[model samples]
Target chain A: MKFKIAILGTGNVAWHLAPALEEAGHTITEVYGRSEKNIKGITQKLYTAESKTDLDFTESIAEIFIIAVSDDAISEISDEIILPEDSILLHTSGSVSIEALGYSSATYTGIFYPLQSFSKDREISFGEVPFLLESEDQTTLQKLKKLAKSLSHLQYVVKSKDRKALHVAAVFASNFSNHMIRLSEEIMARQGLDFEMLKPLIIETLSKSLELGAKKAQTGPAKREDLNTLEAHHQFLNYNEQIAEIYRLISQDIIDSI
Target chain B: MKFKIAILGTGNVAWHLAPALEEAGHTITEVYGRSEKNIKGITQKLYTAESKTDLDFTESIAEIFIIAVSDDAISEISDEIILPEDSILLHTSGSVSIEALGYSSATYTGIFYPLQSFSKDREISFGEVPFLLESEDQTTLQKLKKLAKSLSHLQYVVKSKDRKALHVAAVFASNFSNHMIRLSEEIMARQGLDFEMLKPLIIETLSKSLELGAKKAQTGPAKREDLNTLEAHHQFLNYNEQIAEIYRLISQDIIDSI
Candidate 1:
C-alpha cells in the first residue's frame, strides 16, 4: 500500500506536505526545487530517496507526481516534467483548473488540492484538513480518492468546477480573515492597546460561526445598525484614514447586504 | 459576600450580566428600563426584584448600581436617576468616559465594562470574559474589581482612555472578523460553492492564531505578492464588482503594510 510520490516544489505546501506524506507511510521517491540551498536543506533532513534542482524529472520512479508549485509555475512545471504516460499527475492549486494538465503526456491528470492555508514553520495536521480530489477518469479519481483518504480523514471527490469554487472560497475564508486580524492588530497598535487582548473575542467569534451559522451569529454596529457606536468608532479612527475608510466601506456593505 | 445590586437598563448587557451576577450569589434588588415590557420580563425572571419603567428609579435599590444602557443614554440615564449618596454607580460601557456616571447622585462611580459582545439569544459565560474595571476613586475601583473578580476569571483595571482603545480593538477582532467571514460566504456563494466547506479553514485560521501571532501566521497571495494568483482571482471576481473592489483594497493594504 506504500505508493511512491514525488514533490516538485519547495514552497510552504511542499515543506509541510512532504513530511506529512512520509510520516503517513508513503515513499517520497524524489524531491525537486529551483533553489540549490533550499533543495539541499530539505533533502538533507527529509530526502532519504532523491533530491535535485535540475529538470530531469522522470515518471518511472514514482506512481504519483505532485506539482506543488506556485499557481504561475504549475502549468509550466507540469508541461516540462517528464512523467510516464500511465502515471497520475496532480497539482495542489485551489484556483487553477484541472484541465491545465491536459497538455501533459500523462494519461491521468487531476487536482489534489488541500483546503487549508499552509505556513512553513507551523506544523499543520494533514488529517484535519479536507482534501478535494478530482479526475477526468473514474479509475484515476478512485485511486486519488483512496490515497487522499489514507492521508486525511476528510476527502471529497468534487467536480473540477466545484474544486475551482472551493479554491476561491478558501481565499475568502483563510486569506481575507487573516487580513482582518492584521487590520485589528494595526488598529490596536495605533491606539496603544495590546492586540493580545482581542484573542478571546476572536476565538469566541469563530466558535460562534461553528455553533450558529455566520448569518445568524453576526453582531456589532454594522449588524445592529447602531449608528451611534459606528460614528464613535469612525471618529476614533481619525488618525488612520485608510483603516477608517475600510471600516466605513465594509460596514456599509454588510448593512446593505443584510 | 452577597452584595446588593441594582441593574439600570434591560438591554443586552443587563440581560446577560444580571443573571450572571445572580448566579454568582449577588442579590439584584431592582431592574430598571424605559420599556414596560423589558421591566416586566426582568421582574418576572427575578420575582423578588422590583421592576419599574417610570422616572422614579432610585427607591429601594441596592448599594451597587450597574448602568447597562447605551453609550448615548449613559449620561442621560445617570442624570435622571437618583441614588443613595454612598451607592456605587457603574456604567457597563467600553467607550463612554467614567465622568458620565459622575452626574448620578451616588458619590461612588465607576465602570464595569465586560470585554465581550453579547446578543439577546446567546448565553455567554461571564467567567470567560475579561471585565475591564475603572473608577474615579480608589475605594470604588477596588469594590468594582472585587465584583468583577466574583463574576469572571480575568479582570483588568483599564483606564477610560485605554478602555476606548480596547473597544476599537474589539471592533477589529470581533466585528471586522465577522464581516470577513460574511464576505467569504458571499464569495463562495457567487462561485457556486457551499459556504460550509470553508468552516474547517475558518476554525483552523483562528486556532492557529492562538499559537502563532497573526503577523507570523499570515499567508496567501497578499503575503507572497503572487501577482499571477492575484490577477486570476481578480479576473474571477469580474461579476461581483463590490467584493472585487474590497478584495483588491484589502490585498493591497496587506501587501503595502508587509
Candidate 2:
C-alpha cells in the first residue's frame, strides 16, 4: 500500500526526504514550516505547492507525518503535530529520541534517523543514506522498517541507546575527521600550499584505513614512534599551541593504542 | 634518456616504486636490500632476479639509486652507496633531509619523498602518489625532477624545512583522520554494528569536507553547541575515559575553531 506522508520543516533533511519519498511513489500531501515560503523550494520539488504555516497542524490527512526539524525545535513541532488517530509520527534526528514526539497521544510515535549530513544544494540519493529506525512499539517499529526498507537497503533496527552511541561515533568519524583536514589546510595555508595537493593523500588514506581495518592501517611517525620526525613536527608547530597540543595528544594516543 | 634505477629497500615504497618506474620504461637494473631473499619476492614481479644483498653498494651501475628505506637506515645506507661518479642518489624520506645523503661523496644527492602511506601488499599507481622532490645542487635537482616527472604528474619542488612541515600536515590529514575512523569503529564495534553502515557517512563527510572547505563543512553538536546532545554523548562514554577525553577535547576544539 502506498502510504500518504506529510513532511514538516524546510531544512536539509526535509529537502532531501521530500523528493526522495515522492520519487519512491509515496504521496507527500503537504509540507509544513513556520513559513510556507521557506518550504516552497522543497514542496515544489514534490510537484505539489501545498505548504502551510501552522503552529498547530490541522486539516491534514496522512498515514505518517515526518518531522525533520532541528533537535530543539522537535519538541515544539511535536506539540503542533495533531495528526489523526492510529497514524504515525516520526522525527529524523540522530540525537533526539522518539520520546520528543510524545505530545501526540493519539498517534504512534517513532524515530527515522538518516545517519548522514544533508545539504539543500547537494543532491544525495536517499537509498545511499543509512536509515536508523527505532521505536518502543512493535507495530510502529514494523511500520518504520517497511517505510525505510522502501528507501534504502541500509536499514538498522537499533535501540534508542545504541542509536545514541552510533551518533556519537558518527560525530568523531565525520566532524573530528573534517576538523583534522581543516587543521591540515591551516598548516599548509602558511607555506602557500595548494589544498588540491593534499586531496589524493586524504582520500587514499581513508580508503586504506577502511580496507586494512583501522588498527592495521595506522601509519606515520607517531605510529612508528620516530621521535626525531615527531620532534621536528612539534618544533614546527611551536607557533600554534592548540594545534601542537592536539598533534601531541593524538600521536600519543595512537602510540598508546598500539 | 631512460634512467637506470637501483632501488634500495624492499618495503612498501620500494615495492610500489620499482614496478611503477619499470612500467614507465625506466630500467630497474637491481633491487638492493639487507637480504636478497627478502627482495626476491619484490624483484620477481619486475621479471628479473636482480636482487642484491649488499651492505656496501659498491658495484651498482645505475643513473639513479633511490633509497626507499626507513629513516634511521637512510644514514647508514647512504654511507654504503658507492655509485658511479656524479650519478644521482636520493632518499625517499619526508623527514630526512638531503644532508643525510652527505655520507656519499661519489654521487649527487637529493630527496624523492612520495607523500602517501604505501603498503607492500597493496599495489598503488606511482602517478597517484605526490612526489616531493628536493635538492640543493641545480644539476642534481634537475636530474631528480626529470626522473620524478616521468612517474607522477603531481610533483613539488620543496625545501627540506618546508617538506618537514608538509609531512606534519600530512600526519593530521591522513593519520589523525584515520584514527578518528578507528575510534568510530571501536565505538560501533561495541554494539556489534556493521562497519559498512558507517562507510557511506565517512565517504560523504570527507568529500563534503573537501568540497565545502573543512571549516564550512563542519557539522554536529560541537559545531551547534548543543550541550544536551554533547552531555548525553559524554555520559555514554564515561566508562572509556581515553575515548571520552578525546571526544571532549576534539569537540571543544571544533567549537573553539568556530
Candidate 3:
C-alpha cells in the first residue's frame, strides 16, 4: 500500500501533506522547494526524504510526483516534472484541471486535491480532511484512490471543474467567515469594546448554525426587523463607509432572506 | 437575603432567568405574560409563583419586578409595573438602558442583561453566560449585583451607551456570522453540494480565528490576493447580486485591512 512520494512546493499544503503521507506509511523520497532552509524541518522528521531547490528529475524516481504548488505555478512546475513511462503525476490545486498536469510528459496523471485549507504552522489531522481525486482512466484512478485512502477516509472522485464550484462554496464557509471575525474585531476596537468575551459566542454561533441548519439558526435585529437597534448600529459605523455599507447590505440581505 | 421576584415576559431570556433565579434560592413570587397557556411549565417548576395576564399591583408586592420583555416593550411594561416605596425594578435588556425602567413607580431601578442569545427550547447554563448589570444608584446596583452573582460569576457593570456598543458587537459576532453560514449554505446549494461536509471547516475556522486572533488567523484568496480564484468565484456568483456583492465587498475589506 506504500508508494514513494515527491512533493513539489513547500507551502502550507505541502508542509501538512508531506508529513501525513509519511505517517500513513508512504515514502517521501524527495521534496522540491524554492528554499532549502524552509524544508529542513520537514526533511529531518521524514524518513529518507531529501530537499531540493529545483525540479531537475530527468527520470521519475518516486512512484508518484505531487505538485502541491500555487494555482498559477501548477502548470509551470507540472511541465518541469519528468515522470517515467508508467509513473503518475498530480497537482493539489483545486481550480486547475488535471490537464494542467497532463501537458507534462508523465504517462499517468491525476489529482490528490485535499478539500481543506492548511496553515503551515498549524497541525491538521489529514485523516479527517477530504481528498478529491481525478484521473484519465479507471486503472489510474484506482491507483490514486489506494494512495488517497491510506491518508484520508474522506475521498471523492471530483474533477477540476466541480472542485471549482466547491472551492467557491468554501470561500464563503471558511474564508469570508474568518473575514467576518476580522470585521467583528475591528468594529469592537472602535468602541473600546473587548473582543475576547465574544469568543464563546462566536464558537457557539457557528456550531449551532451547523447543527440546527443555518437558515433556522439565523438571529439578529435584521432577522427580527428591529429597526431601532439596526439604525443605532448604522449610525455607529457611519464614519467608515466600507463598514457601514457592509452592515447595510448584510442586514438588508438577512431581512430579505426572511 | 433572597428577594421575592416577578418576571414579566415568557420569552427565551425570561424562561431561562426565572428557573435560574428560583434555583439560586430567590423566591419567584409571580410570572406575568400575555397568555396563561405559554407559561405553564415555568410556573409549575417555580414555587408559589402565580401566573397572571395583567401587571396590576395595588399594594406592596414582590420586592423586585423584572421586566424581561422586548426592548420596545420594556418602557411600557416598566410604566405599568407598580411596586412598594423602596421596591427594586430591573429590565433584562442589552440595548435598553436602566433609565427605561426609571419611569416606573418602583423606587430602585436597574438592569440585569445576560450577554447571551437564548432559544426557548435550548437549555443554556446560566452560570457560564456573562451577565451585565447597571443601576441608577450604588445601593440598587449592589442589590442587582448580588442577584447577578447568584446566577453567574461573569458579571460586568456596564452603562447604557457602552452596552449599546456591546449589543452591536454581539450582532456581528453571533448574528452576522450565522448569516455568513446561510450565505455559504445558499451558494453551496446551487451546485448540489452537501453543507454537512462543511461543518468541520466552519467549526475549526472560527475556533482558530478566536484562538490565533482573527486578523492573524485569516486565510484564503481574499487574504492571499489570489486574483484568479477570487475572480472565478466572483463570476460563479454573478447572477446573484447579493452574494456577489458580499463577496466583493468583504474581499476588498480584507485586502484593505492588509
For all candidates listed, what's the TM-score of chain B alone?
Answer: 0.94, 0.94, 0.96
**Cα distance off (Å), candidate 2, residue A29:** 1.1
lDDT of 1 by residue, A75-128 (tens): 898788777657889999887888888888677898888888777666787887
Report the C-alpha displacement of residue B24, candidate 3, in angstroms: 2.0
lDDT of 2 by residue, A1-258 (tens): 467888988999998988888888788988888776787878778876388787445566677889988999988888866666687888999888777888764368889998888877687977888898988789889888888888888898887778878888898889999999999998899977777778888988899888888899899988999887888888889998877888888888899898
Categorize the docking of model 1: medium
Q: TM-score of the candidate numbered 1? A: 0.92
Candidate 3's residue-wise lDDT over A1-258, tens digit each? 789888888888888889889889989989888888887857876888888887776554687888988888999988876666677888887778888876787888899888776787778887787788899778889988898899877878876777788777787888777877877787678778777667756766776788898888887789989998899899988888998898999999999999
- Which consecutive 10 residues in model 2 chain B have the weakest lDDT in total? B54-63
Better of 1 and 3 by TM-score: 3
CA lDDT of each candidate?
A: 0.79, 0.84, 0.82
Highest DockQ against the true fold, candidate: 2
Q: After TM-score superposition, what is the CA distance of residue B153 in candidate 1 from its true location, in Å?
A: 3.1
lDDT of 1 by residue, B43-132 (tens): 676747787665454566588988998877889988888776588888998878898877678788898988887777777988788888
Model 1: runs farther than 4 Å from truth?
A: A35-48, A159-161, B34-48, B55-58
Q: Write the per-residue lDDT of candidate 2 for residues B40-152, one digit (tens) a residue.
A: 86898896538888645556667788899888999888887667766778899888888888978545788988887788767677787788888888988887777888888
Candidate 2 structure, TM-score to reference: 0.97
Checking candidate 1 for backbone clashes, the offending pairs are none
The ten-residue window of minimal lDDT in model 1 chain A covers A40-49
